[model samples]
Target: MTHVLILGANGQIARYAIDLLLNETDAQLTLYLRNANRLSNLQSDRVSIREGDVLDLATLKEAMESQDVVYANLSGDMEGQAKNIVKNMEKTGLKRLIFINAFGIYDEIPGEFGKWNQRVIGQYLPPYRKAADIIEDSDLDYTIVRPPWLTNEDEIDYEITQKAGPFIGTVVSRKSVASLVVKMVESPGLHVRRNLGINKPNTNGDRPAFME
Candidate 1:
């Protein structure tokens, strides 16, 4: 069975992805997180939990060994952690990665909404941008999924855009991002070394609501 290691396993999107992978695939999953206590509720024979910070290279190396793919859904200190992950992945000879990043990292959004996004989330974009650059430069086959503001809604219907194309909506469901991650892992050929923006397609002319 394919083995996958997930960083930031306690995150909302990561948890949902874990659930989807558990249900839909027979892969062995290793969940790496700083707080193991938060994941106490998730018990499975195919899942193994590792308590460690992503910034710690030794720990990351230990967790990454023998894993076929690594899915990083990390926040806070993401750039440094991503660099460490890349370095270790090279050392371990594991060449597949799927990164969860934010939509505004590319500065590709247009109009007033784009300006508004820059005003609000702009300060945080640089780190993710740097992280994306690191992944792009690495030898590992990588897929970066950039989602707009996240929501708790349980739906998997969303559209994706490669490169600088706009997704046309403000927010997407966390479950949808999770589903996408699982699909990416199952089929790595679909988005290797490509960055994609994802959002729920607008059904009507009404303004999209922010995901809570």
Candidate 2:
């Protein structure tokens, strides 16, 4: 059975992905986050919770041991986190990494929506871009997911674009991103070394519909 380690396990998308993984696959899961009490209600024979910050390299390495995949759902100081993840994963000899990141990190979004996104969130893109660069430079088999404005809708609907093209759409459901993550977890080779842009199709506008 695959053993998956989830960093920032309390994140909204990681929570959704955790549910999907438990329901759809038999993978053993290690949910790593800063606080255990937040997820104390989560109990399963297939799950374990590790409480520590990603910046804590000793704990991060301990969690990576014997794991088959690492899925990171994180924010704030992502560049530092990426460096630690890469350092430890390389030491542990683990290869697959599915990292969640925000859209526009690559200046890939086009048109008015892109401009709007920059105006609103541009201040936050530098660290994310540096994180992406760090992961890309590593030898690990990694998939960097860049999701556009996210929503809490119950629906699962999304499309994907590679880093080579302009990103499409303005928003995507959290459930949709989780579904994609579960898919990759189930099939490790799905998008290795690729930067993926995910969004709901045809929702393009000056901003996310929810913001309008």
Candidate 3:
């Protein structure tokens, strides 16, 4: 079975993705987080939890070994942590990475509303953008997913666009982002070495056509 390592496993999006992967896919999963207590209930035969900070290169490298893919859904000092992840992955020869980023990082958000979004949420964008830059520059095969405003709504319908492409909407459910991450892990050919933006499409109150 394919082995996948998830960083920030206790995070909301990461938790949802882990649930999806555990139930839907056959991939062996290892969850790496700063606190294992938060993930006490997630233990399973196929799931293993490791307590360690991503900023600690030794811990990250140890966790990344023999892992086919790494999904990073970390918050806080994301840029520095992401840089460390890349360095450790490179050291370990773990080439595949899927990084969760936020929209507006490219300044490609459209309309006056986009401007307001930049003013309000802009401060946090730089670190993610810097993280994306690190991944893009690395030799690793990476997929950087830039999602729009996140909601805890229980829906998994959304759309995705490539870098420099027009963003679809302003908000998306965390469920959708989680679904996309699992999908990418299951099928790496779809989005390797690309930075994509994801959002819910404007449609009727029905299941949307595509996600990622």
Deviation in Å, model 1, residue 24 alpha carbon: 0.9
Per-candidate TM-scores read 0.95, 0.99, 0.93
Arranged by TM-score, best first: 2, 1, 3
Summarize candidate 2's per-residue lDDT along 85-197 as a digit string, tens digits.
99999999999999998899889888999999999999989999999999999999999999988899999999999999999999999999999999999999999999999
Q: After superposition, how far is residue 211 of candidate 2 from its true place, in Å?
A: 1.2
Task: Point to the candidate with the largest TM-score.
Answer: 2
After aligning candidate 1 to the native by TM-score, how far in Å is the CA of 126 from where it should be?
0.9
Candidate 2 structure lDDT: 0.96
Off by over 4 Å in 1: 203-208
Clashes within 3 Å, all models in order: 0, 0, 0
1-212: candidate 3 lDDT, tens digit per residue: 88999999888999899889989999999999898999888668999999999999888889998999999998898889988998998898888899998888888777765776787789778888888888899999999998877788899999888897766677788999999999988997769999999888873221222322
lDDT-wise, the better of 1 and 2 is: 2
Q: Worst 10-residue stretch by lDDT in candidate 3?
A: 203-212
